[model samples]
Target: MAAFRSVLNVANSAKLALSSRTMASHPLAGLLGRLNHVAIATPDLEKSANFYKSLGAKVSEAVPQKEHGVYTVFVELPNSKIELLHPFGEKSPIQAFLNKNKDGGMHHICIEVRCIDEAVKAVRDKKIRTLGEKPKIGAHGKPVMFLHPKDCGGVLIELEQE
Candidate 1:
């Protein structure tokens, strides 16, 4: 229909505009690529994974990162992946997060970037606080860093190197 076509045109135009626009004040603007994954912290990773399985999702095995102190699992989907996270060691980085959110909920969202080092420096220069000393190799085997939730509108953001 003509009406539907017009609406689609407007939507496509909006997407193109957003994709090309860049911010001079914030260096990260126009740099972040796709939404790599959405992460959820779970008290019981097995139970959560099983719940997704009930919905007919293919879930990955629990992968533990000793340095990061979290066990991770990926719920593979047709278009994207959902990462299920759980605290592992005594000094898990997720402890404080779980302490505040007892039921464990959406933890962070990861966006891809071409170069994480450059991205880190740019955001750091803008006074954004990062979780650790430097980017660590994440579950995807890519260098990733976490931006403080306070600086990121109360939602933790992970920037992964593409």
Candidate 2:
């Protein structure tokens, strides 16, 4: 009787573990925050900025990151800024994604978070594939990491914490 009880206990524990795993893997589960910005790839940063400004985005100061070979412009909307990314190099990741997608439209959506490490851990624990394992510096000098589109439907999701 004692051995049977032990076996039943182990089985129950295994079932609980599996249930947690299922919840973690759910598409909508483990979402810690909301969208911060929507990034759009443009061949000309200034042109895109002007376009957005005309739409009442209140564009901010233009900043250039030579290391990543990108010229970033921000348009501050009521809630969030629409990030305009201009690729200065052929190897820019945004350029690659744009080329592959071949759609002149919304690129990636940024999500704001308080704890980047915790956010990344949650993503990993859920077995969601992420691009950068560790947080890296991003546009506007913010700490950010990208979750591959494969894990977030067909839209690239960037997690940002400043």
- Using TM-score as the measure, the top candidate is 1
Tell me the deviation in Å of residue 73 in model 2.
0.6
Best by lDDT: 1
Off by more than 4 A, model 2: 1-31, 101-103
Report the lDDT of model 1 for residue 15. Answer: 86
On the 0 to 100 scale, the lDDT of residue 132 in model 2 is: 66
Give the range of the ten consecutive residues with the poorest summed lDDT in model 2. Answer: 96-105
Q: For model 2, what is the alpha-carbon lDDT of residue 81?
A: 77
- lDDT tens per residue, model 1, 29-133: 767888999999988899999999999999999999887899999999998899999998999967777998998999899999889998888889989999888
For residues 1-162, what per-residue lDDT tens digits would candidate 2 score against the true structure?
A: 999999999999999999999988876465657678898887667777888778876887678777666677888877777888777676776677567656446788998887788888888887888896698888857788889888788888888884
Q: Which ten residues in a row have the lowest lDDT in candidate 1?
A: 19-28
Backbone Cα, N, C clashes tallied per candidate: 0, 0
TM-score of 1: 0.82
Model 1 CA lDDT for position 27: 62
Write down the lDDT of every candidate, Cα atoms only.
0.90, 0.79
